[model samples]
Target: MRAVVYDAPGAFSVREVPVPEPGPGEVRLAVEMAGMCGTDVHIDAGGFFSRYPLTPGHEIVGRVDALGDGVTSLARGEPVVADNTVLCGHCAPCRRGEPLFCANFYSLGVNGPGGFADCVVVRAEKCFAAGDLDLGTAVMAEPTACVVHGLDVLDLRPGADVLVFGAGPTGLVLAQLLAHGGAARVTVAAPTARKLDLARSYGTDVTVEIDRSDPARALPVLRAAAPDGYDVVVDATGAASVVEICLGLVRDGGTFFVYGMADEQLSVPLHPYEVFRRELTIKGSFAQTHCFERSLALLRSGRVRTDGLVTHEFALGDYGLALEATRSDRSCVKAAVVP
Candidate 1:
């Protein structure tokens, strides 16, 4: 077997490794397609909850190759999507019915051996039969699940006017979800024109192309789009500068949602007096909890489209190149590693 092993932060290599066998209640997957995410780059730099000696590819779509003892729900050769999140039921947060805040969280690819290999072991219960979904589309289940979680946090009021910043894969998904999830009008802002075009095709009401390096330059244009300000403002770009500037776009008593993965060290200034006077709600959404089933359903129903979402694919040996392109290449919408 072969895998991309990260010995530590800023260090990794594609090397031959022994194939792992599944334990009780687990199954081994023959990796078919593993989606590369911005979080992977974060993990590579020792950010997030990354654990050393990790095989870090979380968005996985594969076929069940072997089943462990007591795993009778699925059969060998079944196509499926694996949920990467693993939580300890005894954690304080879990006991409080908030598994998202579990004290001991172990996400495959972030803090455990993941799908960046030819074959990887995962809990059988986490594997959802993809049914008739295309492999490329199925790879989006993880991210869509995260978007689902973001929507859960936002809880937009009916007919609310919403604005989303960013047109990358997750950003596009978030915009589409907002468009259908109760927002009367959904507007998307990004640096790329083509991505905005894509957003329009996905039911976005309006699209604005802002200079990524100078987001403030488009402030006048954005204000003209909705002079009263948006009922809900979301920053999906994960850029601290963008977040700081867009926070002002939220209407009075409106909500501001942070859906992007920004740097841990980054900080943005907020006016305490304004928040107090406006009665604003500021919320942040992290990785999902028990949302994969809905994510897969949305994808399967074509409500959340995946066409043209996956713009690039790479060989397992070229994982580093894929990661670099994902981080720096604005032209690359989504990158997948075909193991």
Candidate 2:
């Protein structure tokens, strides 16, 4: 087997490594495709505390090559995707129904070996049949699951006006979910015209081009798109600077959902009294949890499409180039490593 291994922070190498076999209750998957995300970039740059000497890809899809003892639900050569985050079921948070914050939480590609290799092994229960879903699109299951979790946090009313920031892959997926979940109108604001154009194709009713040099210039346009203010305002840019802007767009008594993975040390200046006065709901949505199945079902039903979203790909050996492209290439909606 061959794998992309991170020896340490700011270091990596692709080399021939021994193929791993599944332990009991696990299955080995021949890596088909693994989607690259901002998290991978973070992991590469030492921005995350992921255990090193690792194979860093979480958005993965592969064909089952072998199943371990007691694995009866799956068979060899079945296409599948798995939940990478491993939780200790008896943790205090898990018992509290908050396993996302479990006391002992770890994940593949982060805390353990992952995709980004010719083959990877995972727990059998974590694997889901990718039934007829294209491998490239199946890689979106993790992200879509995150978006579904965000939607769960929203608990929104049907037919409400919505405003979304950013138009990247996740932004577009969020838009589609909002539309399908019954948002009367969904508007997407992004700096890139091409992405906005693609957002339109994803059913966003309006797109606003924000000038990076002067983002405030788009405020009037966004306001005009929702003259009465939006029932829900979402920030998917993952930039701290955009938080206040999205907060301002939320209507009184409306929800402002922070779905972006902003800088950890970043802080926003928000007035407590304002929130108290407006009775506003400000929420933060984190990683995917218990939403993978529905995410796959959405792909199966054709409610979410990735034809225009997966714009770039690289081979396993070109991992560095893939990261560079993800950072510099605005045109690449979703970058994947096709093994």
Candidate 3:
């Protein structure tokens, strides 16, 4: 089977590889549609860690082509989505019920060969029945699950006013979940007017176009939209500059969530005095944490729109162009690889 393999940093190829088969307590997925995410871009650029010659895709939707021994709970030929977390139960973090931070943490897409192939072998427990939706929509299940985890860390209060940075796929999903979590007002800020319009269609109360290079001008327009400040302010741009600027936009007692994946080498300054004086809560959310079922339900119910989110998709052979669309195209919110 042909799989997208990252040979080294800034290098990849769709090479023919052996088809994976299910092992005990495992299941083999026949790749249908896999979502290309920001993390994939980072991995390609050598910013994130990954085993070279890796099949890089975590957000996946496919059918159960085969099931391994002790995997009777699922049926053959059933459509499904795979969870990427693979935790060693004995690890301290797992024992503490926080597998996302396991001392020996590994994920399917990032740590090993994952969904970007004709077939992938995953633990049976990690495969959930695909929601009652088309492949394109079901592909969002993984990322949506991560968004649910972000909300988990946030502990949102009802009727809270919220402002989010970046109107990309993750930011837009965050906006919808905030609305569902009972936030009274939700505003999304991004560099693109097209995405801001997309956010509005998803029921965002306000949308602001931001020019990160000129925060002096953009910040004022954003501040005027909510003069009192917001109960929750989030940076989803994953840009160090944006994250640093978003710190001062939260209300005195409000919280700030770092929902974006910034480069590890980047650093920003924070004022300790202000944090002490205002009682601000700054938190960061990582990968999906066992939220697949609820996320799939929301997507299946049409509460979260998938219409414009998947702006581009390519066949397995066109993987090169697909990667380019993700980086060079500002209009491309999300791209998928269909096999």
Candidate 4:
């Protein structure tokens, strides 16, 4: 089997590796497609600590090639996607139904071998069937699960106005979910006009191009577009500065959601006075858990546009090229590797 191995930070190589077999309660998948994510870039750049010589790809989808003992719900040749979070069911958080916060929670691609290979093994319990969807879209199950987490945490009412920061894949997907959830108005702010255009195509009601030098300028523009400040503001940029700006843009008593992973320590001016006066609620959403199945259902139902999100594709052997393209291609939304 050919696999892309992360030798170390800023280093990766494609090499022929021995094929892996499924262990008990596990299933081996012949990977059809794997999505290259921002986290992959971070891992490559040493932004996140990863085991050296790792296989780094989590947004994966494939057909079951073999199943180990005790795996009965899935059959060979079944198309599926697996939940990224690898949790210990006996952990305190898992016992409380919050596996995302499990004390022993780890993830594929980060803490274990992932799908940047010809075949990958996953727990049968984590796999969800992706009925009748193309491999390209099926690979989006992981990201969509993250979006589902954000949406679930927000709990916004229908017709609520939304302001989303960043027009990257996640932001665009979030916009679509907000629209599907009946948001009356959704504004997407991004520094890139191309991504803003893409967000609009995905149903963002308004798009604002923020000049990098004047990011704060977008706030007033967004407020004017929404008129009542935004009912809900989501910061997906993962930049501390942007998160600080979002705190001021949400309306009184409205909610602010932070769904991005910051690379550095974040320092923001506190507004305890305003927080007390407005009764605003600010929250953060992390990795997916218990949402992977719903995300697959969304794809199976053909409700949200996932195919268009794949702007680039590469062969498994061209892993380096794929990572380079993801880092440099401003117009690319999501890139996938097919094995």
The RMSD of every model to the true structure, in order and in angstroms, is 0.8, 1.4, 1.3, 1.8
Write out the backbone clash pairs for model 3.
none
TM-score against truth, every candidate? 0.98, 0.96, 0.97, 0.94
What candidate 4 gets wrong by more than 4 Å, as runs, is none
lDDT per residue as tens, model 1, 107-165:
98999999889988999999999959998899999999999999998998989999999
Across 1-339, the per-residue lDDT of candidate 3 in tens digits comes to: 999888887888888998887889998989899999889888888766687778888888888888899999888889899888788889888999988888877787787888888988889998888747887788888889999999999999999999999888889999999998999999888888899899999999988888857644578887887787889999887888788778688989899899999998988998999889999999999987689988888898888877888999999888888889888798799999998
Among the numbered candidates, top TM-score falls to 1
All models: lDDT?
0.91, 0.86, 0.87, 0.84
Off by over 4 Å in 1: none
lDDT of 2 by residue, 117-182 (tens): 999998998898995887778999998998999899898799999999888789999999999999
lDDT of 1: 0.91
Rank by TM-score (best first): 1, 3, 2, 4
- What is the Cα-based lDDT of residue 85 in candidate 4? 77
**Ranking under lDDT, best-scoring first?**
1, 3, 2, 4
- What is the Å distance of residue 149 in model 4 from its true position? 1.5
lDDT of 2 at 313: 86
